[model samples]
Structure formats: structure tokens, C-alpha cells
Target: MNTQSYMTSYEILVYTGDKRGAGTDSNVSITLFSKNGKQTGKIPLKNSNNKDPFERKQVDKFCVKGDYIGELTKLHIEHDNSGRSSGWFLDKIVVTDIFDPKTQYVATCNQWLAKDEGDRKISRDLTLHKQQTTTQKSNYYKVTVYTGNKSGAGTNSDVSLTLYGNLGEAGPMKLANQEDNFEPGKKDEFTIECQNVGELNQIFIAHNNKGLSAAWFLDSIVIEDLYAMHTYQFPCHRWLAKNEDDGKIARFLVPQSSTTETPQIRKHNQYKVTVFTGNKSGAGTDADVFITLFGNQGQTGQIKLDNEKDNFETGQKDEFIVECPAVGEINKILIEHNNKGLSSGWFLDRILIEDTQGHRTYEFPCNRWLAKDEDDKQIARYLVPRPKVKNNQYKVTVFTGNKSGAGTDADVFITLFGNQGQTGQIKLDNEKDNFETGQKDEFIVECPAVGEINKILIEHNNKGLSS
Candidate 1:
């Protein structure tokens, strides 16, 4: 072992040659010795052909003991002979420190080759390569915490981080300082060493009540792996309070840019709307619940909920499946009730709108009474519809089964038709392909514009065959 501070192991490359008359059955072993002539370990050399002459081996996580200097003192090679014509030749031995395995150590050999002729023993004095101490660098991580927009409402001093890695859960590592206790509208950055722990997989933020206010409005968190030069951001657009159900918010801090896209109308024309009536103290059942839908093109007229069974009642809820004739993207919604009198108004709690394709669901909250003088205000919000499934491509599975009197294989052809007409066609045996009997194959095809699939035409060259 060398005195290099970063060295923790050693590797040895042994080169053996099979020379004629070198005694093929000879066994050669190399024994390592400490400073006081004490044997540590023995490595037997497996003889290999001269064409491929190198055998690499390593001794990792090894340390010398006692009054010995941090180096291998000597190497002793022992040989035993078996009655054979071909002999073994010790070509060379290369020793290197684990930290810099390419740098070799210098050795003085007392006997270079071990053979069956006369002296059957050999020894060598090994000396490590003299080099400057190299220090191992630790990885650094920078964490930036952002407080919400509220003024003077910062996080507490007891804010900590839970880091998950290969070494298991490391800590709720404390992030505290007296000067700035994660104040609102302020950014606090903390640097941490990640050497002791393994690679980070996920992170969680824990908040406690130890500052000026117990409630901490969090905006976001940004973490940077300094050594890897990568950054991750976690959005926390919520409050962190002491009395909250959970004081910790966990998230995957992935590095990605935020993007926004215009919502698109789904293929189906039907939509489901569920309205929940509020159970407030002053709430009352109202007549004629009028709801209007707003889209990208234009707005719909007042669609009156005249059905008595579907009207909103205090502490009661109802759902309706409505069909829209307009073809555009839904962006907003408005709900109002006919307030016949002050005691006959609807206290709407929330309304859920679901697209017919089940692709998008929008929830609108209304915490006020409709048509109740001061509380009679319209509830509306902008919404973006999510796609239920990818509509661009569809998987078509083709089943090929032979009936009685039908052959074992057939050349099949298929044509698919949508609302607009024939979309695609493929011949299974256009390239002389064969669909084996009782077997199935799948193909992917691009879907036509959103509509019902009209029909499918399948033909086979072989007679009496069905697909």
C-alpha cells in the first residue's frame, strides 16, 4: 500500500508464459509479506498460453496492521515441480494502487523465473510508487427554498429536508440560521455534502412552528447537484402549517420546463355534470337552476335545469348527462339559480364537469348562495381539458384461424374504413408473408379524424379460410 491518502485498494496483473521445457506441471505461488516478515496472503498463478498472457486480479478494502509502513515489504514466489517436459515462465508482475491503478510499483526480483532446473524457488522485494497525497472530493448539493407571496409570513427555523438515496433515508437534515428564518417572499439557500449518502432519488420538506408565525406559505423548492451540474425543482404552491394534517410535503424534484397548451374538444359529444348543493346555515332550495357553458368559439345560451327532480336543494346533490351541439373547446362555465325570494335561493357548494370521453374533469367551487342579495354572485373559472387517451394511433389485432377443410395458412388482406371512408389497407402476403393457422398478429394504424369506425373488410387468397 502506498501513502497516497486516496488509496484504499491494490490490483495486480500477472503475466505467465508457457515455454517449451519450462516444466508444464510446475505450480507457482506469490506470497505477500509485511515489514516484519509476516505473511499476509498467497496468490497462485494459473499458467496460461503465450498467445494470451495477462491475468488481472485485485485486492480491495485491504489495510496493513501493526508497526509496518503502509507498503508491501516483500513478495516470495514458491515453485513445485511435477515430472513434465514443458515448463512455466514468470513473464512479469505489475502492481498498482487502487486510486491510480495505471501507475505501477517498482520491484526488485531475486529470481526472475521459477523452473524445475536446479533452484526451484524465487523471491522479489516490492516497492510502491512514490506519489503526492491525493484527496478525494465530496459531492455538494444546493437547496433553495422559496416562501409564498404573503408579506411577513415566513417559514420556521425548524425547517428540515428528508433525502432518500441508496444508503436508505439519511435525515430530516436541519436547515436553520438566526438571521433569516425562511421569511415570506424571500429565498433561502442551503448547501449540503452528499458524499456520505448515496445518489438522491426523492426529497421531502418538513416544516415546524418555531418562527414568528406557525403557518409557512411555500412557493417552490429548487435543488442542485453541484458535482453533476444538474438542477431539480419541486412546486409547492400551498401552505405549510403546524396544525395541518401533514407537516411534510414530499415530491419528486425533476428538472423540467413548464408548458401550457390549448385544450381540444374530445371525439364524443356527451358530457356529465354533477352539482352539489351547499349545506350552509342560511342556505335554501331554489327553482330553475340555469347553467351556461363557455367554449373557445362562443358561449351557449342559458340551459335551464327545469326538471324538478334535477333542481338543486339544500344539502342535496344531482347529476345530469347533457349533449352539446357546438363543436369547440370548453374553457369556462357559469351557474346561476332563479332566486324567487330571499329564503328560496340555492347555496351551491361545488360543480364537477366531465367530458363524455372521460378525458377531462373540471371542478368549480362556489362557497356562496345564488340570488341571495349580497351573496348572489355568479361562480366561474377558466379550465383546461385533459386528454383521456392518445387518439393518434390505434392497435389492430388480426386473428387468423382455419376452419375444417381450410388449409394451415392463408394470405390475408385487410382494409379499414372510418366515418370519412377507407383509411388504410394492408395485404398480409404482399411480400409472400403467411399467417400461420390458429395464430394472431397485431398491427398499428393511424386513426382518422374523431368519429365512429365504419367497417373492416378482410379477404384471403386461400379458399374457405375465415379471419
Candidate 2:
């Protein structure tokens, strides 16, 4: 009946090992932690009876008073390692709230907790454990990839496909096996385990542009979710190549159902895109150029800027038309080129996109290099409209686990992806000791607006402990 603080009581049931030397006369103590709040100080365990607790093959029970801890999650238990039989072999501990009998937490630690035994650790931090009575069912799907039958339509590059749905996206699933896959007028089939993204909305297909003939003319893709009993089709009649139709390697395609409900697929808008190559020496490239527009309504995927005459010369202004759904207002655009041709370096100056249907224009200024060995060594560039849009500062909060050794000193970074574009890997560092065990760290990242973030990538270098 110790009265330091007593809002609730927890019944601690400790199980000692059945071995001959498992008995211990050492003083045992425990600290409890719960989801709602913390419990003040640790509680000593003893009995008024003539017999000592912690006997071999015995269940020692004790009642401790502490603060109201709702639904226990973890606890700290240790012995002073003082008595003659201090080298005890502990089995497990089960804690229950006396007020709320239904709330129980079990921690299994079948190891030696003595300085002279095991890892030579005298104390143990035990987390909540539960027996798994059932297995998690995995979602499996049948993926079919169809290649177009055009002149040199086959690609020798490695292809990756990702499926997106109302549930989420799955894969960068490899689409290659043996037998020289992705041949002209051919189809490749494979089975994959992906989370059942209910009612797929789109598919993102791409290639690394490697190998000898890395140009791919993808015709269509069909996926059957065996668990959900649903089928989704993504039709693509274009080329995913660095030098082909779009000079782009990545693409996002919506399912047939989405296009069917888009009022009418024929009721699309055409956007006139004007590209100006930098006037400097070797500023122009023969590489295929592509663009994707993002606005208030939505975004259009990569569109190729193709023309009859030789385009993208020194200080050349090339114009092309792109047709898609009406993007309400102009926001930004992603411009890039395939590192093709003998001289594949190109410096882009600026871009102007005119919405023919909406009668609005958006200008994105680049004035940078998109070469493999030049400035930034990036072939792709994301530019906002003219007038130089200011950067967006996003407050990002990260929660580190509360378990043992859940903190790290490694440099952490995060990347955010949305319907518009993605942000680069921004470091998550501050003046404080961040990422401590069970710590909530907040960081402000200043970057362009990645409109409507869809995915966030979090990672850290493995230089530190328990990253």
C-alpha cells in the first residue's frame, strides 16, 4: 500500500524459469508505460509471507499502484543483481489493469538478465507481445504485357510496371523473364504478389533505356486481381523510348473505365507547346523532347514535341500540340529529353504552353543544362510558370518507435511525391537530438509545391544505430 501516487493498480505476473538455478533472491522492480500517459517511478515487488518470491518453476505475483495508464504498450523491468542466486533466468511477464480487466499486456523475455550471463545486461525493456492466431492473406495478381507490332517496336531494355488503384499502387514489377521478352507483336505474362489495390485506377510503366534497342512500343496491359475478382485494363499505343515517339522512358496510364467516364474521350483539349533551345554552343540537342503540364484541375502525362522539320537546333523555337483533358489553369510543366544522338547534350532556355481550349498560357523558364555530364547531370527538368513561383515550405513530422534502441544518429532524408511532381530528398536535421526513441521530430522543408502529395519516401543512411 505504498502511497506515492495511486490512480490505478496493475497486477504483475512474473514467470521464472524451471531450471535448477533459475531461482533468485534479488530485489525485482518494474516501470510501466501506456498509450495515454506515463506512470510515475518504479514499483518494488515483495511479499509479506515467510517465503521469498522468484523461486524456480514458480509464478510470482505482486500488485503495484501507479498512475492511470490506458492500454499498456511497454515496461521496464530489472533486478538489483544483489542476492546469492542473482543469476536468474526469467521466462515472461504478464501485466493486467485491475480497473480495466480487459486491458492486458504480455511481454515474453526468455533470457538471462544477469551481469554474469547472456549479453551481460542486467535490465530489460520489454515491449507488448501478442500471439498471432492467423496468417495474413496476400493479394496475388496476373499481369499481362502486350507489345505493339510496329517496325522495330521491340525493346531490349528492362521494363518495370506499377499498378495504381483506389487502394494504392504496387510494383515497379519487373516485366522480363527469359526468351527475349518484349518482342514485336508479343505478350509477356507473369504472376506477382501485390496488395489488393481495389479497382485499379492507373498503371505506370517504364524502362531503364538500357541494352541494345531499348525502345519499347507498349500496346496494352491487363491485370487480374485473383483475390478481389476484378480486372483492369490499361491501353497504351505509344513508345517508351529515349529516341522514339515521346523520347521519354516513364509514363502513367489510367484504366479504360476512367477514360470512359471522362464525359467523352474525344472531348479533349489540345495544348500548344513552344520550346526554345539555349543559344550557346552545344546548347541544342537532337534528343527527343517531352513535356507534361500540371494545373489546377489535373495533369497531363509526358507528351512528345514532334515536328516535320529538324527541331531543337541552336536557339531553335519548336512548337508542338498536345491533346488531353482540360487542365483548368496553368501551373507548371516537366520538360526533358532523351540523351540520344552522337552529341546528346542540350541546354534548355525556356518553355511556353498555351491552352488552346482555355485560352491561357504558362511559361516555364529553365536556362539550365539537361545533359548527362553537364550542369546537375539531369536530363529532366521541372519548371513553374513565368514570374518565378516562390518556394513552398512544408512542415513534416516524423515519429520514431518507442521500443528498445529506436533512435539513430544517421542522416535522415525524405522525398514527397504527388499528382503534380516530386521533391528532392530533403534532409531531416535540426539543432536538437532528433530521432530519439519515441520522439516526435518536426522539420520544415522548403521546396516547390508538390501539389496534393500522394507518397512520401523516408530513408536514412545505415551509419548509426537502429536506424
Candidate 3:
């Protein structure tokens, strides 16, 4: 036998005949011997429980530690002495390596009827078995990359990635050119189809080197199996620039649980406003500028820029810090200037608003003049709050079946919709949630604010059945 086969485990099948006529118990033993005639291990086969003439029995998963350098050459069987009437018969014997599917028929004997036939012994030659090569199953994965939110700096058309697995390495897959050129605050996905490639271990990202502005600020990457639903997220909070010494960034694809918790609203009580005055047209320097911030709950009082120090002078810029006492999200901002006469209005360039608490910034650009007959310059921008840690709680009772009828045996899904346009869904299994016929289950759902839940929709595996 080869080294691999000798070191592996085996299963032996034996057949023993009934010795009822013989008084003593019918004992059968099969012994193994190396090429040098050294006795190795012995396997005692179980006797037949049935009183039939000949019965076949099997001994599964028998193992023997063999010297890898040597091979087994001989096989011997010994039967205990019986009464004077007759002797036990050895119907057959077969050996198979459990690990080797190709070497299933290691040794076989049709009928080596072993009995004291006038004190004569019978022996049969055994042939060694060889092992065969086998192949393993392959796995597939899908990788998704998300770019960061940096204004015109690191957003480019060329984003490449290299995936490494147990089998081998797979490509420097390039991301397709998107409308935004895979720019900041953009996302793109790539698929990796491989055969016999094990779990994804590491990935290397390369940014575009076409130009200095072609670099990317990568946010995160999500890798998931094509068949499996779980996703692994790798957060990269750094810039991938070709000009840097180390242009490529490598990260381990660590598995992470998907979150279903509600995202918290960002609080922007402290605000910083940077006002840029003057436009390319070179108009309106004498008019006073007025600005107002409107939030979800309330609005900031009208702020006027009348003083010469804070006036909207040509090609001049100023900064202001305003704090809001209201406890809601900022939704809109209005910018207007007094249109007393020609050249009396201000030419607006742009306004930058920063939320100190959330570390979020927004720019409202207006290139035209804020003068007479111009529409009220209202920029309707929604400043979504940063996800805050949730503390509010809710209790939900799911009815598998009511008094009217019982639901079918299937999984149940529930979705909670909030007044703020936030929604969350959870799945419940029939057996896990104890959703038997006419049974109800209660669950505690955690959210950022309990009062935001406007309604809940429940659905079952059955089609078209939802409330």
C-alpha cells in the first residue's frame, strides 16, 4: 500500500457462518502483517445473530498505524476450535480505505471457506491498493466598494482591486467608469468567479494614476458569497493616491454581522457658516445680504449683513458662527438681499454650512445676482442627521394565527415604518418563534425613537397575505 493509503483509516466487511452444530462459540479474527512478516493489528468480527446457514456482518471504520516506509503483504484468519461435529466457515472478507473513494475495493474474497479440512490450511494472495487524486469544490464571491465623500479631490474613473484566496490570486479587476467616475460619495460593485478558490483572505486596492486628482478616498468594501447572503465589511478610512510612496492599500476581508438597527438622527445645534461674496459678473456691492436657516421644528431669525465690516463687498468673504436652540434637523436655507435699485443687490457666490456635532458640511452655490424680480433664493436641502446610538424601545406582538384562522406553516416577516421615512424589517421562523397554530409571539424592538413608528406591516411566507 502507498504511504497515504497506509496512514488512512479503513473499513472491513466479514461474513461468518453459523456453528450451532459445533458446541463451542464460533470465534473469528482477521490479522494484518507487514511486508517483513511483522504482525500489525487484528480485527475481531462480530458473529451472526441469525440462525441462518451463512450470515454477512461488517466492521466499520477500523484503523491501524502503519510505518509509512513499509507496506502490508499478508492477511491471516484464525477460527477458534469447535466440537467434533463440524467447524466454522469464513464466507468472505473485504477491506476498504475509508478516506479513499477510488480504493474502495482494497481486498476481496468470494468464499475463503476456512475450516479444519483434515488439518490442511488454505491461503490466498493479497494485492496492494493505490490511491487516486480528487478535486475540491469551488466557491464564488461578490465584492462591492464604496468611495468616500471628499469634494472634487479623490474621485476618479480608475479603481482596481486584487483578490487573494487559498487556491490562487485573482486579477487586478478594474471598476467600470461610472457617471461620477467612481467619485467621492459613489459606490460600485465587482464580481469574482473562481473555481476551487477557498475563502477570500486579502484584497489590495489600487487607485487611478492618470492624474493627481484621479485618486480615491475609499470608505469601505463589502464582500459576500454569490450563494450565501452574509456580507463582510472592511472599513478603509484612508486615501489611495498614486503620488504617495505606498499607493496601494491591502486589507483583510474580515466577516461582520449585518446591522438592522435604526440609524440615529444627527444633532446640529452648533453651526458654522462661511459666506463667499462676489460673482464673475462683478455686480451688486451696495446691497445688504440677509440669510435665514429653516429646520424641521423651527426657523432661525432673519440674519442681516448691513454693516460695512460684514457687508457683501465685491470679491470679499466672511465667516459667522450661529447656534440653534431647536432640537430638529436642518432642512432648508433662504438667501436674499435688499433689491432697492440697480447695483444695490449683492452678487452671491456660495454659502458653506457645517454641522459641528455631526461633522457634516454642505455648500449652497448661487452664481446669479440676488437682485430685483429674482425669485426668493430658497435652497431646499435635507441635512440627514448622523446615525446616533439607539435608546428607545418598543414591544411587538406577532400573531401566527388569530381566532378567525391560523396561518400556514412558514416564516413571518415584519416591517416597521417610521414617520421620518425610516423603516426596519425582521424575519421570524415558524419553529424558532413558536408560531404554531393560533399562537402569538412577542418581541422587543429597539429604535432611536419609539414615537417615530407610524405603522407596522406584517407578512408571511404565503403570498398576498399581509397586514
- Full ranking by TM-score: 2, 1, 3
Task: Please provide, for model 2 over 51-109, each residue's C-alpha lDDT reduced to its tens digit, 9 standing for 90 to 100.
Answer: 77888878887656668656677888899999888988889998865444444679988
lDDT, model 2, position 360: 42
Estimate the TM-score of every prediction. Answer: 0.27, 0.33, 0.26
In model 2, the runs with Cα more than 4 Å from the true position are 1-137, 258-467
Q: Which residue pairs in candidate 3 collide?
A: 264-388, 266-385, 266-386
lDDT by residue for model 3 (1-467), tens: 44444343334555543443222244555666656656546556442333432333422233333322244555666655443433444444555433332343344444333455523343444454444445433445677778788765455446666664433445677766344556568677766665423334445566546655766677778888543233566666656665442354332232222352552222225566777876555454665455567666555534444334635667777776654333245566777654444466566777766654443444666666665544354322223334443545567776665645464555566656576433334454334535656877776755445346788777665632421
Better of 1 and 3 by lDDT: 1
Residue 43 lDDT in candidate 2 = 81
> Which window of ten consecutive residues has the lowest lDDT sum in model 1?
57-66
After the best TM-score superposition of candidate 2, give how far the Cα of residue 255 lies from its true spot, in angstroms. 0.6
In candidate 2 the C-alpha lDDT for residue 412 amounts to 87
Q: Which window of 10 residues has the lowest lDDT sum in candidate 2?
A: 129-138
| Candidate 2 residue pairs that clash | none
lDDT at 178 for candidate 3? 40
Off by over 4 Å in 1: 1-138, 166-168, 196-199, 242-467
Global local distance difference test of model 3: 0.52
| Candidate 3 TM-score over all chains jointly | 0.26
Can you rank all candidates by lDDT, best first?
2, 1, 3
lDDT of 1 by residue, 1-467 (tens): 65532313343455444444433444555665545555545656543323222212211111121222245555665555543532444544545443343345444432334444436544444543443333432456788888877864575547778664432334567876456657778888888774423334445566656655767777778877553345666666656675542343332232223232543322214566788888876565645565667776555444445445735767777887654334355666767654554466567777766653423455666666665454525422233333322345557676656755333355565656566433333454423334555656676655333356788877766543343
lDDT of each: 0.52, 0.75, 0.52
